[model samples]
Structure formats: structure tokens, C-alpha cells
Target: MAQLRYIYSMPVERIVRYFNDNGFHVNKATANGLLSKTADMFENLYTALGRAVLEDNYISCDETYYKVMDRTGNPDALNINKEYIWAMFAMNLNLAYYFYENGSSRGDVIHKKLEKYKGTVQSNGYAPYKSLRGEILRVSCFQHCKRKFLDLQGNPDADKIIELINRLYQQEHKHCIGADEWTQEDNLKWRRKYSKDIMKALKVALKRIISSPEYPPKSQMYTAANYMLGEWKGLENIFSSGIYKLDTNTIERLNRYISLSRRNSLFFVSHRGAERGAIFYSLACSCRLGGINSFEYLSDVINKAASLPPDTSLEKYRNLLPDKWSKK
Candidate 1:
């Protein structure tokens, strides 16, 4: 039973090795078989997390790559497919939900998932997300803008960009009333007072750098300048509300497990296996965010899941969610 919990936190091969070291021999296939049999429980838990995230007023979207092993039609050929897993997290709710298309991370999946969403989305400058500018409030990631310049260290132009961005972050820190205590009204007022001017100055600086012939088009400074200028409108959207975050760092932090899992496990054997992995990780991370003991929560949910009808409505099991279940 305890070994089942480890599956979400580590690769199955590690779990099998741990069991073998402890005088029990288990194979990777058997470990995955256990997870596969409990697919209903994972799906139900993921559904609950999804519902919670969707209920929030602010969301952060981020994506990371995962590898999937694709069995080609030609018997002689084997292909390792590159796939993307996207996470849409609710900042206020401290919940996250993940999704992966069969093998693609294009605009269609973005459109389908967020079609009904109607709040500010904080993400890096991805064109698919940018396309939703009119449909939803698009807030750019400041960390992304800073990263572009950070890569060009020692360049005078890049240093200037980093310094200006740091100053803007300093204003945010200065205006924050207390640790996580700033109310929406106070945040909006503080941004208007301190951040608006910095944003205006940044726009001017970016335009001038981008227009200058001193740097070639292919140079990092030119690229950084162009990125910032192109994303200016979305970046300025930060000033529209105090509730909007400067970056998607919150959700990005949640991605460490997924990234680590990819590195350890290498690749999912099939598309269905990848989806199951997504479901398990979603539940585990959401539990961590909600301060629930995921092992206990999963045990309880698994017991309850056994009694549920095949077509159980996810809404009916909402109480099983980490936040609500933890209260019990």
C-alpha cells in the first residue's frame, strides 16, 4: 500500500528496486499494473482538482516537455515522440490541473481548455496564449523577460535591461504592505502609484533598443528588445489589477516534479500511460498545495472510489478533494 504512494513521487523502476532491496521482488510491469487498475481513482481525483481550478478568478498557465514512446506503423522503426504537458493553476485556490494532448501542444488544445475561462492568465510569451488576448486578460511573465537578458550577461545593453527590471521588482516589494496581506484594492492602488511609471519607462527603453542599428537582428540584445516590445501590451496588463501576478512562477514551481519525473522515468510507454501519469501527478501536487497528506487522501479516495458507480459525477465526489477531505 505504501509503495503505491511512492509511484506518484518517483519512477516505478525505483519503487521496484526499493522493494527488491527490502526482500520483495517486484517488476516495473507489476507496479504499472497496479496503477493501471486504479485508473478510475486517479481520473476522479484529477477531475476534482480540475473543478477547483476552474472555479478560481485568476489562473497561471505553464507547459513543460515530456517524452512519449510512439510505436510506428513500420515494425522496424521506433519513435520517441516529444509531447508537452500544460498546467493551469488557480493562484488563490492553491490548486493545479494538468493536461496533455495525445502528442501535440499547439493552439487548439489551449483554445479548447481555456475557451470558457474569463480571467487574467499569467504565462510566458507563447503565441497560442497571445492569441487569447482579446478573449481573456493576458499578463506576461516578468521572469521570462528577465531570463532573456540574463543569458547575455556582460553586455551593456543587457545589463541595462536587467537593472531596470530589477528596479520594477523592487517597487513591488516596497509597496507590498505585508507578507501575503495586501488586499486587491491596496495592490491596485500601490501599482498605480509605483509600477505604472516603471512600465512606461521600460516601453520607451525597449523601443529605442529594438530600433537601433547598432545591434544586429540576430543578436541576443535585439532578440530581448524585440520580445519585450512585442509583449509590451500584455506586460502592461499587470497594472490593470493588483490580483495579477508578475510571473507564472507559482505554477512553474509546481512543475519541478513533472520535470524530475521525466528525467528519471525517461518516457511513457503509451499515450494512455502518459495520461494516467498526468492524473496521478495532478492529484499528488494538488494535495501538496492544499496541505493534505496525499497518501492518506489517496487511500481514502481509493476506498470510496470502489463503491462509486461507473458513471459517478465528479461533482458528487467533490468532498474527496484535498481541501475538503482534509477538513474531515
Candidate 2:
């Protein structure tokens, strides 16, 4: 099942065929039954990963949509419902948590997921983040801001803004010696000396673009300039702290597998199935983030969780986490 889901990402039909070809005569029904039963074990790993992600002083979050079979009958509803799969991971730590939200209410769901979190959350400039401004430090992704202007390439004002942002990135690239080699204090010093000046220039460029006659109200340039101006504080937050990242590109890269799985399998049969998939994906990502072997990590986690009492507390479960268990 782990091989089919995590390694190959094989659908049920393909999984059954692979087993049958290997001399095991398991059919699709049998394969699915086994898969469903493993949800409990997957939940154990997912819950542990979630706790670790929330405990971090910093995390990056993003969500993608997936189709689910709908049981509800709203007047405006179609045969299927669009559900959101949120990926939130610790920025400095090797942990990722995937969550399934069956509705479109981003504000409430984000608040619930990050209820007690007091650290900065770096995300693409989504309006829902406005709700979290007071509760936690809101940070915007420069990559996202740059992408918006990249779409309007012919405009001079847009080109200037992009050039300014490029300079900041160049400064970052110059100092980066990989996280393993670079000291945080040195990194902070470089950013303060160089990146801060470029950001100040970018701010001035943004105001110029907003005031320019070339950027009419409701135009794409106007919208892009407005967004950058509105989220300036968040974008500037990275300069204030060495720990803050320039973008949420790390978590965005992790979402590639989710996209691949969705394209292949189409839609989950049920919400329960979707949640189970989230559990598996979370554990799989946790393994990748921690540099642990997925097969070994999943096998050990399932085995250890099964050996314990069903009523075990989160503390006991934490010991079995990949980062913790790997040391043992």
C-alpha cells in the first residue's frame, strides 16, 4: 500500500495489477479494503506531524483545490463539490501537515488551524491573510508579487518594479551559502546592508506606478501596484528577521505531488478517502522534510503506534515522530 500510494502513486486498478503480476492474486476490492484499514495508522502519523507543525515558531501555508463527491443538495450545487487541501509546514524545521477543508471559508479555517500560533506566517498575497494580521505577524511572498507584474511585461512602470525586486533577490542569492554553511547572524547582516536598500527603492517605485497615468483605475497595472503597496509591510518583514523567508516557494514545491496525484486519480470517492489521502501525504512529506526513508518511517510509525494502547496521549505519540524516533 505504501509503495502504491507513496512511491508509485498508483491508482487502485494499477495496484491490484502490480500485485497480481508479482504472484499475489489480490484484486482491487481487496487492495482498497487494506488501504482503508491503514487510515488509523496514517492518522497517528498525521496527528503527530500536525502537532509538530503548530508548535513551530514559524510556518508557511498554502492550499490547493480538489474535487469531492457531494452528498449535499444545495440549489446552486453541482454533482461534485470543490474542496480545499491546505499544506502548512514549519519553516525552519522538517515537518509538513496537510489538511482537508470541505468548504470555501478560508478565514475561519485558517484561524482554526493557526489558533495559538504567534510567529510569522509567510504566504502568497491572499486576502484571507488579512484576518490574521493582528494575531500573528503577516509576511508576503515577493515571488508572488513579482509574478503579478511579470504578467504585464510591456509596461515601463511594471518593468521598473520587477527590476527593483530582481536586485533584492540578487542580493539574497549573493549571500546564500546554503542553510548548512551560512550563519544566521552573517545572513542577517548581509540582508540588512543590501536587501533593505533595494526594498526601499521598490517601495518608491510602487508608489510611482500607482500614481502614474499609465496605470488607470481597475487596470491590471493598477491592481498589481495596489497589491504590492498594500502588502509592503509583509514583504518588508523578511528584512527585519533572519528567520523569515523571502517566499513560500518551499511549501509550494511540496505541493507538486498533490497535483500529480489529483491529475491521475481524478477525485476521491468520499470525504473520508480524501482525509485518508491527506494523512498519507502528510506522513510522506514529513519523511521527505526530515530526510528519513518513507518506507522505513511509515513501517516504524505504524508498528510503534500499533504496539501502544489505543488511548495513548499526544506526548507518547510525539516520541514516535520522525525527528524524535530517528534519533532513537
Candidate 3:
């Protein structure tokens, strides 16, 4: 069962063929059955997760594009567009998890983050979150804001704009890094300066794009310019509040784990199958964070959870963890 986790893909018959040709006796049905059984174990883990966590947990969400072939047997099936699926990861103190194939919009992800959330909410500046219209504490990521400018670093006109954006970022970052004993007037002064510079840069960049024939038709300039133009208020909103940040680095890091599974095989035949893969990925990510041996922990978790009283299994599992939980 543990060895199966490392196997990305192979038909059961191929493994059986290898064994048979090598004088081993593993049969076709048995190999297929074994695969199904291990898959079921992950499905069980998914069921266990839903009943495990309490309300004090954080569930951060984001979405990305997923591709699929149309079933109509067209020759262009490979190039056809499919749905955009969402993957939502719930992060609490003890564990983090993944749930997949839900809504995929800027609105849906933010809506999930805002829904019934009572504690601090950490995320990127994805517009729909702004309409959340609540007092929930939002901590955006500086890494996210900095990266937008970073993306435009090599851009000709955008290089100047990146510097301007960085200056705005740094002005607020200075306060975060203990630069101020600042007052309302000081903040307003900085904001007005940032807004004016942002407006000026946008005007210049737009004019340059309009007049320049040398610009690439689909280029970083438009991406950078449009973002600054559309998100100027949110970018400037950083200085107004002492708490709000410029991006959502936490979610970005979280994204790497859940998303890697998507990239590995490029597709899952069903959301349920993806759900099982997500459990393993979530566990792998959590184990990485805690500096535990993921395979050993998973083996221990699966082996032990199988024997514990079903009523107290999750509790028993929690107690067995090396981090602040009790003995097995």
C-alpha cells in the first residue's frame, strides 16, 4: 500500500505481466483489486477529514484553469476548452486539507474565504474579496504585490512603473517594519503621492502603448498597465489600513501543494479521484511543513487508524501526532 503512493501510473496488467514473466505469481485480478483497495483507503481518509476539524479553522480557497476533451468525438477534442475547477484547502492548526472541483471565479474563491469566517482571513487582492464588505481581518501578501512588479521587471516602460509600484509598496512596508510613529496626515500625504504617481504612470504607459509600433501585440506592458489601472484603489488601500497587506503569500505557498497533483498527470477522470489525490497531497504538504517523514507518518496513520475505535479514531490520531498531541 505504501509503495503504491510512489507509483504515478501503470496499468495493472503491465505489472502482472512483469511479475509473471519474472517467475512471480501475481495475477491480473489481484493486481487490479489491490489498486482499487488502496484507492479506497484514500477515499476513507477524505471521509475522515470532513468530520475531523472544528470551527476555529481557516479555509482558504483559489482556482485555476483545468482542461478536458469534449465527448463529441470531434478531431479537435484535444484543443477544446472545458470547465475551470476550483480547489479549496482548509487550514487549521493541526492539519491542512484539499477539496476540489468546485466553483472557479475570482468571486467564488473570495466568497468561500469570506463565508462564515470569524478569524483572520489571509489572501491575495483578487477583487471579489473586496466586495466581501465585512470587518473580517484581511492580511494580503507583500510577496503577491511585489511579484506583480517583478513580472514587469524586464518590461521597457513597465520597468519605470515597477519602480513606482515598489516605492508605494515600500512606503507601507516601512510602517510594517517599524519605520513609523506616523500620523493621519503623514499617511494621507503618502497615499496622495502614491495615487498621483500611479495615475501619472498609467497615463504615460497608455499613451506610449497607443503610439508605439514597436510594442508586442500581447505583451507584459498591457498586463502590468491594466493591473495598475484597474487595481489602483486596492493598491493604494494598503496605506489606509495598518493591517491589510498587498498580497496572499500564504495561499500562494498552499497553492503549490494542491496544484502539483494537477500538473503531475495533467488530468483526473473524475473529481472523486482528484479528491483522493488531494488527500495525499494535503498530507504530504502538512508533513513537509512539520518536518515529518510523510510516508512513515502516512503508514502509521493508515495502519493505526484502521485499528482504533471508530468513534474515537480522529481523536486518537490527533493524540498520536508529534506536535503537541499526546501519545499513541
Candidate 4:
């Protein structure tokens, strides 16, 4: 019932209706209680997944907004009605973790979450991401840079920049043929050999447009060029390793499930409900990524979790993760 509600985006009332139609009478409160209890069972495993993500070397980060009914009387709570849900995806491990901290999207929330992280973090170069601490190597999204110019369709300068960007992607596609068979060294060599020059040419073109007096500072062309130039370092970080993608497309694609759920169910009734939804969303999406049936996985784990001690070892919880559970 919980899986149907969260993973399948079925509202509780609709779920109850389906049950009643099948000759099983269930109330909305009972359905909500089941969801709460299932979330309690999955909470420990969710924490374990988060720890694993923080320990990973490569992570993609993104955030989306949600509406929450705030009953908290605190006047200074930032954007009480509008909350943000952040996602961290570990590419190497095929793991994902979602976080909702008091319905806050402030820099402090993310800064504290990633305080101990020390590896490459890929994002769209949002301002809050720039403020993250630790040994984090920030990588910007090329698609974001491309979109800036894409929005200025008729401008010749923007079109030229877009053409150069397309060439880089073409080279990337050519090298990615049978990429599953590629070694780290092979990926490194291909990027250095084929992509290096194209990136150099693109950089030069961006600088030329930035320095041109014809395009005013406030013009769309100038803004696009400046934005790309400002994010140049992060964009160039792609060549550092073949493991890095040109954008946060993978995580962004995963975020669609959150969007789907939001569109169907709308706002969470409280902060606690939002947090529980995060746990379900994290585990459900990770199950999808690992090609596991989420319903079966959740059913098994929820039972296993019930039989375990409250002080169960971290290893026990980790074994319940989607990838780990699928292997058994």
C-alpha cells in the first residue's frame, strides 16, 4: 500500500478505493498509518544509503521545490510554505539519497550536509553550490551553458557558440561507441586527443564575444557569453576524467519521479510527511536504477527491518540497500 502510494504516485484515497473495489475495506487513516509505519521500517536503511553516498568519489547533486503546509509558529523559518528536496546521486555505486531539512533550501543546509565530503561534485553551478566547503571539486553543466545560448535562437553569435558546443558533443559521442569496454586510460587518452582542441576553440570564441563592443552588457548574447565564461573552469573539469558527464542529466532524469509524485499528490501535510516521502523516494528510485522491483524489495526489507533489533549494525542495514539486496 505504501509502495503504491509513494512509488506509483497513487493517492491514498484512490488506493483505498482500489482496495474497497477488491472486497477489502480500508480507510484513509489506516492507509496513512501504514505509510508511516513502513517509513519507520525503512528509516535506518535510508540513513545507511546517505552515508554510502557521502563516502563515494563521484556524486551528482540537484534540488526541486515542494509545497508543505507549515504549522510551525517560528516566524524566521525560511520559505515555510515552499520547501526544497535535495538529491545526491552516487554514479559509481548506483545509489541515491534524498534530503529534506526543515523545509529549508538555504546554503547552510547544503553546506552542513556536505561538510565532510571530499570529492567531485557536479551541479548546474547554482550559487549555493559555490559556497560548499571541503575538498569538493565543483563541475558545471555544459547543457546549462548551451541552454543560455539556445534561448537566444536568432542571434548569429549565439548560434556560432552553439555550433562549437555541438561539435564537442559529437566528438564525445564518437568516443563513447562501445564505451562499456573502455578502460580509464582509454577514456583519458580519447578526451585529451579529440576533445582538447575543440574545448580550446570554444573558449576562444566565448572570449571574443565577451570582449566585443557590439554586444552590450545587458544584451542576451553578452549575458550568455559571460555566463559560459564565468563557468569555464567547471565546464573544463570534464576533461579531467571520462567518468564525468557533460551535465547532471542522470540526476535530473531521476528527479522526474519526484515531479510526477508532486503533480499527482500535490503538497505534503507536514514536515514529517515530507521527510518520510524522502525516504520512500530515495529507496524507490534507487531500486529502479538497479533494475530491482521496488515493491518486492520494499516488502522484503520492511519485514526484515521489523524482525531486527533497534541497535542493529550498520552492515545489517546496508545489506537491505537496493543493489545489495538485489544481489541476494
TM-score of each: 0.92, 0.92, 0.58, 0.93
Model 4 local distance difference test score: 0.86
Q: How many residue pairs clash in each candidate?
A: 0, 0, 3, 0
The model with the greater TM-score, 2 or 4, is 4
Runs of candidate 4 exceeding 4 Å displacement? 74-80, 177-180
Write one digit per residue (lDDT tens) for candidate 4, span 84-162: 9999999888998999997788888888889989999999878888777779999888998999999987888888889
After TM-score superposition, the amount by which residue 275's alpha carbon in candidate 1 deviates from its true location, in angstroms, is: 0.4
Worst 10 residues of 3 by lDDT: 1-10
Evaluated against the true structure, the overall lDDT of model 3 is 0.52
RMSD of each: 2.3, 2.6, 7.3, 2.6
The total of clashing pairs for model 3 equals 3
Candidate 1 lDDT, tens digit per residue, 1-328?
A: 3324333556777788888999998888887888888765567767777877877878899888889988858556678889988888888877778887886788888888888887778888999888973458888988899999999989877887888889878888775645577787898888888876787778777888888898789977889999988888888888888778788888888898887778777888878877877777677777778877777777778888788887888886777776677533
Candidate 2 residue-wise lDDT, 1-328, digit = tens: 7656754567778777888899999987787788777777657656877988888878898988777776665545555667888889887777888888673546788878787888888888777776684558888898888989999988788899889888887878876646668877888888899976787788888888889897797899989989988888888788887667888888988888778777777777777778878888887877787888888877777777778877888888877776777633
Of 1 and 4, the candidate ranking higher by TM-score = 4
- What's the lDDT for all of these models? 0.79, 0.79, 0.52, 0.86
Candidate 4, TM-score vs. the true structure?
0.93
Which whole-number lDDT from 0 to 100 does residue 218 have in model 2? 88
* Clash pairs for candidate 1: none
Residue 137 error for model 4, in Å? Answer: 1.3
